[model samples]
Target: MTLGLDEEHRELGASLRAWAAGLDGPAAVRAAEGDPAETFEKVRAAAAGMGLAGLALPASAGGDDGSPLDVAVALEACAHALLPGPLLGPAVSELLLAGGHPGSDAVVGLAPGAPDLVWDAPSATHLLLPAPGEDDTWVLVEAAAVDVEPVVALDLSRRFGRVRAPWSGGVAVTGLTRARVRRTTVAMAAAEASGVARWCLETATSYAGVREQFGKPIGSFQAVKHLCAEMLETAEAVTAAAWDAAVALAADEEQAAFAADVAGAVALDGAVRVAQTCIQVLGGIGFTFEHDAHLYLRRATTLRALLGGGDVWAASLAARAASGVRRRVEVDLGGRDAGVRDEFRTRVAEVAALPEDARRAALVERGYLTPHWPAPYGLGADPVTQLVVDEELVRAGIGRPDLKIGGWAAPTVLEHGTDAQRERFVRPTLTGEIGWCQLFSEPGAGSDLASLRTRAVRDEAAGGWRLTGQKVWTSLAHEADWAICLARTDPDAPRHRGITYFLVDMGSPGIEIRPLRELTGDAMFNEVFLDDVLVPDDCVVGQPGDGWRLARTTLANERVAMASSRLGVSTERAVALAGDATPAEQVRVGHAVALATVCTLLGVRTTLRSLAGHGPGAESSVAKLLGVRSRQDASELVVELLGERVVLEADDPQVAADVHEMLMTRCLSIAGGTTQVLRTVAAERILGLPR
Candidate 1:
């Protein structure tokens, strides 16, 4: 959940946190506010002694030559403690210098452009300024060479000043490019932003848990819980985005700029939003000067401002994405499975050599289709092996067949069904011979699925169960060969209990499927009516009262499936539609791209955890919530880009598709689980907010 994932980075973060705590940064800031001359000299010296100033610089520059990720972890910890004094400016300046510039030990200020406010100007020994009319060129000058007019800034933690410098007097730094400098700056700043967001979220949630109102803890209220949940989402988004930006910068990949732009767009603004929400959660006490909440808000706001505003970053991101820049997320297994990888590659190649029609069966036979499942049904592959198989399959251009509803159904059958049931269903479903649909959601029990009214009565003469129920929003019901049905077996039992998981044949007598037209005018979903449909006793999964537990397993499988899904279709379409977009439209597109990227990062973090043999983190649930919003927003943005053309239904097929997509995405929030209900779940389960 923090910027650092592994043990080394965690240790570094912990060390920094301990170090920052000793500084009592807020008190130092308070002192600086009283005496501008008290510039925290000891604090700066301590940071320098820790080698943080040149953390990302090369060893030739007297730095440790650490990766940008290392710097990010340190910055995040420092920012969480509200550490003041010139960290960002000095670090950025060192990176820009790259060991060649003459001021490695000097405190440096960054003036992004001409007549721009310089950060840390009062204490800066040198200034980094953009070269006049030189397009991406920058110059380094001593602070004495420029005139600085100190400004009263919103962020009390740091000082700012407008600098008047002769552009020709500074030494032109040719080693660093504007793109490199900007990306580094934004990435590092985003790390700090994430820290601010993390602090806000933790502070708010902790305060809400104990803060009382109306004879109860405010966190017990749904509204407050939801607010804290939302703050968690934003804070996680900020962390993921910033972490990704640092990763990209350290790797120096082709799409590094795009990644940094995403951080700039999402992390900076998200931090500001989280800080503001933290204050809201803290109530009246948060609004006062004595509270530390506004300080974080000021810091977040300042970072966003210094980075050329969120809109600018968003537009840049959109423009880059429109030009076909995508941040590729690949898992690095660190050669741990060299032999396994080679074996997978050979097997995948063999499968690829088979006729396209035979590939699915080949994959299923070889256990490549469901590597994470148990042996025979799958390879019982660990997370690393699963990822390796995925990579090899993609490398061989072999796309795995989507199991659709069978994905959920087959998993449950494998885990909880009898041997005969697995033999009859799992392989056929895997091979696409037997299509499956779910009959769980009823008219009144969608998100509250346990409240389903479908009833099942035992038929002693028939030696099976007679089911009668109406299931709505059943995807692929009309085309499915079978269904996994949930029906109440005991009306007097608790809502969740007394239900039985049944495997029902779609062609059973008295079963009817009526296609339901969606807003997109498609009948992909259906309403299934079961009138005394008979399901054999052998088709029951687990015991009569085990349906709820089995249903949870099925839902868990669905979440796993969702987690492995690619970056959404809507995000890609939005990028495609972003060409020639207006600035305002670009901003929206940029925001969408940032969100989509964060969703991917969340998945990456989850995978990394799995690779490390750790349990799943909160990223999985957060990813689902954020993914729905990302897809919905992107799809809507696509329609907005269509503008007046959206009214013309069939005139332009692409426009029609865009419109349909927007409508289709509306189901994302409603389906699986409603956003509101999921938010409450996240509040209780993840954030530990009272229901």
Candidate 2:
């Protein structure tokens, strides 16, 4: 199941956002709190005015005549702003109407205390209650028929009224069946839970970035950072699961049930964890009545139990899965192909066989090498196949082969390179005969790559061009055979339009390479001074002024590459680390491990999307940020578990390695993209914030 907003869906989001942005904002939500009637009316009016009432309504009804996916879209936007009863009412009613039930003047009653609750019983036209069995079947009742008695709720923006209905007009859409209703309601519940989880994360994260303590934003501290990161991840998992379920519901019934089950369990878990961690991150104020964090927490606890809890879903899924038990199957790879499980034996064999460079040669011979390169370049594996290759490599304890030149530089050439250019560079990249480095980043231009100063002047005398400038952070230039350089080929045009991508040989005269010392004391990056480095005209990639667009194909893929962690560990590490530690230490370790596994899965899920042409988008940035946070948490767990030894040199190899890894983890945030940069990227690109 796929989850994303296409162009039209995005347009719908913008419209809804603009409408909601005009409402009272937090001030309105705050004002309406406690005054159930006033708040419900205000929120309800706003929601109805925006067509939330008819979002999933069929054309036969007085509705937008849309799909359930459309309803999911509207619900997500409403969830983002913490919109109150108004949006919830229509959404619930629309669901009822979509299911062919009589839903007018009906309100949806979510399980009590659902965080991000849009359910306000007093204002709902009908209320939907969960009745669990093989599928989620809800008992719907008219608001008038409900013997609703108002109950005080933690969140003032929403109010709950206990409802009892024993009436016939509360008709079940006969053909829809109990199982189908259960699936839909569970999916909706999961979606709403995700929305709440996200809100908590966004709230805590924004606060962390600004709320200074001890002369620094608390977010700078590893403790606060880890908590916020966990919150973000919890939110992400819920969102991913919910969307997966929603899309599945739209596409297939059985998958929808599985998706719903997964969503319900994960969303409930995520909502609760995110809310609790957010409260901890916010400290004292987060616990106060004046703060909104508690409301979300209360809602999370209530809603998690409202649907069949996580244990119930887990049991259900487990029971179903166990019934499918079959013996493990094996296939012939002819000592050529390897499955994920073959890693241990494969690694032992690879290490034993390697006398010197035979291992590299074997990798190339076996087709596992350069799996990321397009077909003609080598293994010809697509991203999905590449992921499988990566997992096998990591499991086998194999290090990533040095291929900055071929793996990174050749893809763009294959996509846009002239036939001559591809013939010259492609095969060599796979064979590892030629090494490459990128020369795009500069002091003045980082994210803004097109605003570069490097120039490639026409050198008709040599039937090529002469380039002269400095390029910073050029990895592998010291050993590079060539560099794929982006330079100003038509300086008179607009910044983005004037650039050209060129292939520059490192052996060219006047090109000098110098390694830049890093905090880690590794000179992995270099600054290259290109002084009249000549490049033949045949080396020009694509057209003269299409470099900016071509560069994206390379740069965007870099995020997915970096996200592919070679140091693959598991939840077991986190669990074992804290078992013998103090209480605080155990919680820290447990949280980190669970968080890491969750984040790793999220990374895989998002990578799948990016490979599908969704681009990295905001979702990728969120994953990257979460990855950095997970690394930090893992580092802290190691440090705390080791106690005094981390602060002092250790004689034990394992202890020494732990300390080294802790220090290395510091660079996690600084690499791929900084946490700070990714946050702004999320705000601008994902959240639709202004520049």
Candidate 3:
């Protein structure tokens, strides 16, 4: 999201990508496959010539002492070009030494577990691992003292071999902990994965732009467009995950472990998906050995497997989070936004300092309650201003009361209602003095919301209209003071053209509300019946037959309000619940953690786009699609983590809550729009697909 990415970093990445192109790209990668030694020397010499060997090493050690993020950017670029050589292990070794492990000039390699094959062992002067029969200590053995037997590897881009080292004569190293080593390795691997994913995205997109089918570029097809869009999303997610790891490691932040686990958990899987999809985009050529797509897929798969795959890391993420670990992604609002943000922060602080009971009124008086609205009612904030206000509010531990339906309703009214209507409703709605609910969806109409059967007959004789309709899934209807309604004003008109927008009083005659119990055993949703309810003409929001249009606006508002930078909330709780989780449950928990992190990354990318002057864009739609999946998946994991405890004792408090949350997630996919419906939206609307 460009949180701390500078021009220098951008140039560094570009330079590396270009440099890798000049070195050996995918063609070289394929040739070096199964036998890296033949082609390794040339790239090694080139890297050393560019001083890449000591990039992560301290300046005092004749190195650049580059930040972890800097190293990550470089790796991502290198991997994007499929640049070969034993890069990862040596860089990691340099980082370890900087952290006080003893090593110099010698290439260093690492082995993860007991009696493991160490990649790049042939080129290493030393190897590091936990010492045998030693407590909290590590051993560094000379390469000559180790037996290296070359073995075939899935990713032929790098070399690997079995290593049997003499630990008895090894140098004992202090302060190089297992936890630290694992964190660094996982983080760096994710960084490399990010590069692979980026290359897949770029290559596939570039191909789509040129490849033609049925008289047009393949990119013009909805299927291809959607594929590319998803690829873009995965690319961003991979980068975000890797960036989190690199940032945490370089800063030695509190979330170093948490961030690294999430990166390893999500990046590997995302990279694999992206690479495979890239092949699909390339069609027949992608399957042939002549194409480079398989090479990337191999490398991505190997890297994922090298670190015990996404499942292992995901489980680790859940275990860590369950232990009260949290990861937060912070953005640096550069230049003008930074100064503007500080100014708003102080004002927000002043309002926040008030007693809890009095805070709402203060916020309203300052026009911060609905900053996106026009002046007097609000500041009419632009995207940047809106985000600044949002950031400040979250920081001050202050929350603005959600105006419920009024959020969209009031905006709809202001945009279309007469001054008298505005004076009667907008102010109170913004201040929370009036509560609003929506009556748009009917049992027969959900995603096809325009097909609703509610009736609103005009009564010119009286100054109002008689309304009769049934609204399903009407949340807050039982508690609402007012409702923004949709009813068919003219059944003779077309399906979408006949609906009209109206505001109905909850206390009106013939209005009945029955609670609809859900799988959670909670009646948060209700079925509202309006039998001949009277609605004054003044209560109408817009011209008759405008319900569908206004309802769409309200629906959009709902989606935006529901969007968030959090998905791991439940997973974190589930982690705590599954402290002694079984291996299977641990893997499930890990999957949830990874999903949550990716959801967050997606949201960050969206906000970044908005802040960059792009209005919402494709992510707004894409997020809903993925977010529904994340929420539902995480909820299911919570229940699965509980295992038989949930089934045996359905009434247990914790068990019940987890079950309820899981059941509640069912609505996510069906609510604003079904997953199928959203995908089509992305394909046709965003991706330019045929209907």
Maximum-lDDT candidate: 1
**Tens-digit per-residue lDDT, 1-691, candidate 2:** 1234455666776676567657744556677654657866777776766667766777666667777667776676665566766455456446644746453333455432332232566676665554323244445556676566666565555666664433334544334554665567666666667767877878887787778888887776666665665565567777766665566566555556655666665677778898898888788889887787876776667667557666555444433222331111111223333444355346536753676456666666656666555544445554545555665665556664666556667788878898888888876776678888888888787666878998888988899888888898776788888888999888899989988889988888898888998655678789999898888889988888898888877522333432432223322333445545665655454345334434544665556554554655445556577667777777667767778765575877766666666676787775555666656555444433233
lDDT of 3 by residue, 453-488 (tens): 989888888889999989999889989999988899
lDDT of 2: 0.64
Once superposed on the true structure, which residue ranges of model 1 sit more than 4 Å away at CA? Answer: 49-51, 101-105, 113-116, 131-136, 164-171, 251-254, 554-567
- Cα deviation at 333, candidate 2, in Å, is 22
Candidate 3, RMSD to the unseen true structure = 5.2
Candidate 2: stretches off by over 4 Å: 1-150, 157-191, 197-238, 241-374, 378-402, 490-493, 554-576, 607-617, 647-651
Q: 149-187, model 1: which lDDT tens digit per residue?
A: 887688898888885644457888876677787888898
Clashes of each: 0, 15, 2
Better of 2 and 3 by lDDT: 3
* Worst-scoring 10-residue span by lDDT in model 3: 554-563
Could you estimate the TM-score for every candidate?
Answer: 0.94, 0.57, 0.79
Give all candidates' CA lDDT scores.
Answer: 0.85, 0.64, 0.77
Best by TM-score: 1
